[model samples]
Target chain A: MNRYVKLVNFELGRFMKVYIALIGITIISQLAAVIVVSKSYLNNANQAMNVDHMAIETFIEQYGRMSFNDVTNSIFFIGPIALCIVTLLIYSLFIWYRDWFGKNTFIYRLLMLPTARLNVYLAKASAIFLFVLGLVGLQILLLPLERMILQWMVPIDLRWDLSINEMIRNFDRLGIMLPYSIAEFAIHYGIGFMAVIVLFTIIMFERCYRLKGILLGIGYGALALIVFFLPVFVQEFMLYNYFYPEELFMLMLVTGLLVTAGSIWMSNHLLTRKIRV
Target chain B: MIEVKDITKKFGRKQVLRGVTFTAAKGEITCLIGINGVGKTTILNAIMALTPINSGQILIDGAKINKKSYEKITFIPDAITMLPQMTIGQSMQFMQDFYESWNQERATELLGFFKLKPEEKISSLSKGNTAKVNLLLGLALDVDYLLMDEPFSGIDIFSREQIAEVFTSHLVEDRGVIITTHEINDIEHLIDQVILLDDGIVVKAFNSEEIRENEGKSVVDVMREVYQQ
Candidate 1:
């Protein structure tokens, strides 16, 4: 177990500089989101008279009640776009062309540490998990800023009472205190997002062959289709439309762990057979 | 010490290594030589626990070399295989963090000796320089056994000489070193043992001193005789 930690630390250490840059980008993006949302809230608040408080509150609630489908679509769309752009700029242009990214030899070189391949996989997976968690934490921090942005955008007549601290206090009331611990509502969604990456990291080894890359992408789509409707398929597709937050978190965590396991399992299994570079 | 028994590996019905068996003693250099596609690299990879054998057992110091054995052995392939997106410095740091045997000071000194800039990405290095880095990595490891595949291929004569000197400086007693290469002239003086591999079978295994004393021939000559049968 201790050896595993060292391997993971080393795995993450390889990308420490890049991770630092990633965190900076995340902070900046969250700050922007906060500003944008806060301005929008403020603008809407200015238009409403005192008598229309209830009406405006209703409006905000109705508008903000984004369905799971909405959130999933919004978040997943960001996944590929963000990843591609970042990888292209950071890795393809700077690392690939320059030959600085050692991931091309990740399996043969990096994974061959004086430890188990399972441990190596877990370490890298942990680093990615932490990377995504850091972004979510920053996003949570920017919530009040977003509220401020909303007000700035609309200049509503209603008086502002909630400071960023109060809103965060409400979050604490909701559950959990540490920045690392996400809102209960978000743990599933965030973990699911990460699980997809874990699965890809393992299956992406197929990139050694052009055909395999396409096949893996398609495979990802297929697995997503199955995971999306798994509850429906197991219990009853029509009745199980809604997801329980705790249940969802549990399911997402399990699937993430399984896929994480599968990723290492597949990598180790396939490597035993001598796959492509 | 290492021993392999009843090992067979087939790649899609093509039997590359068929029921091959061999033993390598501690603190001795065991050179495996064979023609291309004859499973020379496969055997080395298998022994190093990089590749899995179809049906066999590999024992290292009486303990099987499995995921458990990985923490002790380091395999250096024939080519300079590293993440092209890293500097020699970053690579050294990574190795140092993971392996107990990694010596950072030796790594830095060797990097300087090779004239490779720490900032230079591996992609920019010439093939010879790449090979130098690969050898540098192997030499910097403070391990019990070092397995190198074709360490001298494609390297310039002068660089090979320098690398040889580096290896000589780093070689410690009771620390096994196994290197495979067809370029016998480059490493002829350094080898202590010869394990002649032909058609994936160990036809001859000799102590270098004994061969030189009794047979009165270099490894190249002895290698020719072992394969002649």
Candidate 2:
């Protein structure tokens, strides 16, 4: 196939092991979490009604029904999701560093490839993006299955059922992960894509420069952050309620495009011109 | 042909290559001989554009180095270029995937020549075998020019001998080679030209046979006189 695709495949292959492990962990842990939380709720109900000799009505009155919120808040549920996110963040940085700082100098081979050096950068960015989307998709597919398990363990009266959409709308993290509509999806993932691009650029800065580049990288990151949020600041303070919400979104989209283009250009320059093997 | 003109490179405050200049013509082996840490590897790196040069220019076949020029030249680094987890076969596949000029036939031949198993992981190979795999990767590429950084730096006696044998074999025929090494004794007779580097400067660059014939002294003899003086 094409060099870009090949590079992407190579990059994906590089991180496939860790990515699979993260997926396995998420599935196993979340399922176990649902089971544990459901059982715990049942046990509490049993103790109050049977052991304490309290009426079932009194127990029902005292303890509210177990809801989607309680199921999600359990360590087994949110804990694995949080773990996956944190691990992916660490892997994002590790992906860049492994080529250079790892035992073998794999960057030499990558840089020497006959393709335009930017393919390497884009390939890496694409791999990270692919991984993020894969995990999100997995979480999305898991919700209905999780709901089925909740229904199986907790009785109808004692459990509060919520559809996936309602759950996402209620929970902030889920909402971010799974946006309500197309426009919101685009906005949310657009921001995520930009963040990845900017992060890769900052990594390029550090890779090209070394100890001194760390400060330059951090400074560059702060500059990018300012540029990205500039339209918001303008709308709020400088414009004094001049633009509508849609207008602000258009400005932000334009800003995001400009920053992404700039990031790609700068990353290419560093990869081709300044980066040392 | 590969021509490096007045290339200068620096790492932070320290100057690694200072106005370095040299050339390696096609069908010739140019040996860049120097002591350790004298920017021998840096010069090779600059020629291949693996690392940036602060000033000066590098040209391959009378044109500046670029993505297209890379197709004509290959670098076999002193250190392992493939990931430690990758098998020799996987590494070859990786090379074959990116490079249009990659010759699987040559790679297979070298794999047999070096007696390296294709399925062996890079990390499992001995230093000498790893060096052989590195050489195999470079030699397999059907490129006009090859830049090798210390192919014989720290290998066992047998692997070094195997690598040295490839210089005379048909595997490297008609390919321009620029090799950097502080230990010159290994490939002394194999080299066509010698470039002596001292403190990032090209102290001397001359035909190896010419120096031996006209000056009636070995490269080591000349090195002693130049370095001691």
Best by lDDT: 2
| Per-residue C-alpha lDDT of model 2 across residues B127-149, encoded as one tens digit per residue | 99999998898898899998899
Question: What DockQ does candidate 2 score?
Answer: 0.84
- The residue-level lDDT of candidate 2 at B12 comes to 73
| Candidate 1: tens digits of C-alpha lDDT, residues A73-169 | 2333234326533543343223212221343345566446666655654565565555555555655565555565445544343334455545544
lDDT of 1 by residue, B81-164 (tens): 567777887778767776677888878888888888888898788878888888787778877777888877777888888777
Taking the candidates in order, what DockQ does each have?
0.34, 0.84
A142 Cα displacement, candidate 1 (Å): 3.1
Give fnat, all candidates. Answer: 0.48, 0.86
Q: Relative to the unseen true structure, what is the C-alpha lDDT of residue B213 in candidate 2, on a scale of 0 to 100?
A: 89
Candidate by candidate, in order, the iRMS in Å equals 3.7, 1.0
Model 1, DockQ value? Answer: 0.34
Worst 10-residue lDDT window, candidate 2 chain B: B42-51
